[model samples]
Target: MSVPVPYHATAQRPEWSSLPARLRAEVSTRMGAPVIQARTAGAGFTRGFAALLRTADGQSAFVKAAPHAEQPHLVDWYAREAAILTRLPAGLPAPRPRWTLWEAGWYVLCLDPVDGHTPRLPWDQAELTATLTAFADVAEALAEPPVELTALGLPRLADLARDDLLWWGEVAAGREQVPPLPAPARGRLADLVTLESRLPRYAAAATGLTHGDLRVDNVLVDTAGSVWFCDWPWLCHGPAWFDLVTLLITGYATGLDVDSLFAAQPAAASAPDDALDVTLAALAGYHLTAATSAPPTASTNLPAHQRWTGEQAIRWLSHRRGWL
Candidate 1:
């Protein structure tokens, strides 16, 4: 629960010069004007090429390029994100992907750049309020699943939770080793498993599309103080409160009265009484287990971020359950 470093600052992105000349030319050709300036995005864990490109004729676009020869997974993720963005409702406060193309063994996605910056840590009260309000609008807009959108084969959150979100159960059954824990939380694997295992049952009834990944780094605050969500590869059907929980974890880490803040949001209004506890338990298990695994070749800071997030989750859960 300590004030940790900014997660996004740790990423090592590909420079503009590192991109293939052919692909860069294709981007210029598509923009219909020579590139005048480019500023790389300072956030994200991936090593893909992401930057705001400005043309001599005053046109600007946010471009992301992933090389199939190297970051193949990133290519797949970026391609999937582009496909999802086009189908998202127009009223949502998310950036729209404008176009996508393949050139020189790389996949490229273009989007309209937002005039904004990442929210600062130890979040300003107004910024946090604005973000929560904007996402409430998002939850309202996607309350019901659209046939065309659902037809894209987005996985149901409950199914995903059952498959990949139960690390405590793994440890309880001796399939995975237990990670270090607080003094009071040690030897509580059965309790952790009990809480984490209920996620599927609790999430199964949800029908709305949720932003599967809702971290502070993925959010942008514009000059007008409006919030914009980015990165859409994890979109799925789940209760909107799940996304709210993910966004507010950092708030809790930073010492915000997130319990009350969460209650005030419309997204959490319909959530079950134990919904927050269930999510925090599952998150603690997932991140703690992940922190013990081998780090990705890229994303050097991921392990540290995972550890901090897991500890914060466990701290929140313990306080709520009176584990002390």
Candidate 2:
């Protein structure tokens, strides 16, 4: 039996212990700490549960558990995240890897706790500017030597769905009765899909690892207002614009000045600067799908899938019309 170490006040039990003995052990070992208590962290498709554990020596760590839910190659996806972390460029705000463990046929990720407080966002222009500057710098660093998404055990965007309708449609399937998808919104999605298909060719020419999901919620801002990216489960190798698009969409949704934010980066200056447009289209589809696919959890604010979808489409169209 492993000797029990002193539990830190900051440390708590994992939410999985009530689940099963195997999961408890798995969570403990991966975190390099003993499981004292655990619980649901929030409501997200990929993130189901999280916990705070304390090493016998009093270090607190975080353990996130994402179970496979009909997602193809879920195990491989988890492995890919670990791989991406291993190769993160110097000076970016990504979390440091602690350990990756497999237990009870589940992947358990233990990562060092980032030292920061969650910031009040949609950030002001200053904060958004700083974050984008950092993002552009990282993009440039990765432009030269791109890491393959699959090589790191992650799936490419192509693997995410068989077709645009099948991919985004399924996520919104259950929401047809509530705030039904407007016909114009549906048409817009189809149009975006047509444009997105051309992305592979464009992506091939540009370079770098994409964070895939750059929502402000995934960023940690300390008292000093410095930010760090936390989740890497969706890391991918793709066009530089992909990440910029993700960041811009997040800023736009959260009510920030995305243009000035992105302009701070020299690399982004020459890029198409259509990040916000693309991102709005993608997220409108994504959130609609998520609301349809997952069981209702408290964190999700999507009342009707199509409502979000239409609103997002309008935002995208308005941007295209230069209203933004």
How does each model score on TM-score? Answer: 0.96, 0.70
Task: Say what the RMSD of model 2 is.
Answer: 8.1
Q: Where does candidate 2 have its weakest 10-residue lDDT segment?
A: 1-10
The TM-score of candidate 1 is 0.96
Across 1-324, the per-residue lDDT of candidate 2 in tens digits comes to 110111111122235655457877666665556756443433223324455556565667766654454322545655666777777766777776778775555666666676554434445666665676667776777666544434555445444423332234343355332333544554444555544444444444454556666654566665677777777777655555666655555455556555665565555654554544544555555555545554433223433423443355446445654543
Clashing pairs in 1: none
Superposed Cα deviation of residue 176, candidate 1 (Å): 1.2
Worst 10 residues of 1 by lDDT: 1-10
Q: How many clashes in each structure?
A: 0, 8
> What TM value does model 2 have?
0.70
Summarize candidate 1's per-residue lDDT along 1-324 as a digit string, tens digits.
453557547566887777889988889999989877888887777678888899999999999998898789899889889888888888888889888999999999999888778887889888988898899899998899777788889988899898888899998889998988876678778889988888888788887889889988789898988999999999998999999988999998889998998899998888999999999999999988988873464566777788888888898888878889
Residue 62 miss distance in model 2 (angstroms)? 1.6
lDDT of each: 0.86, 0.53
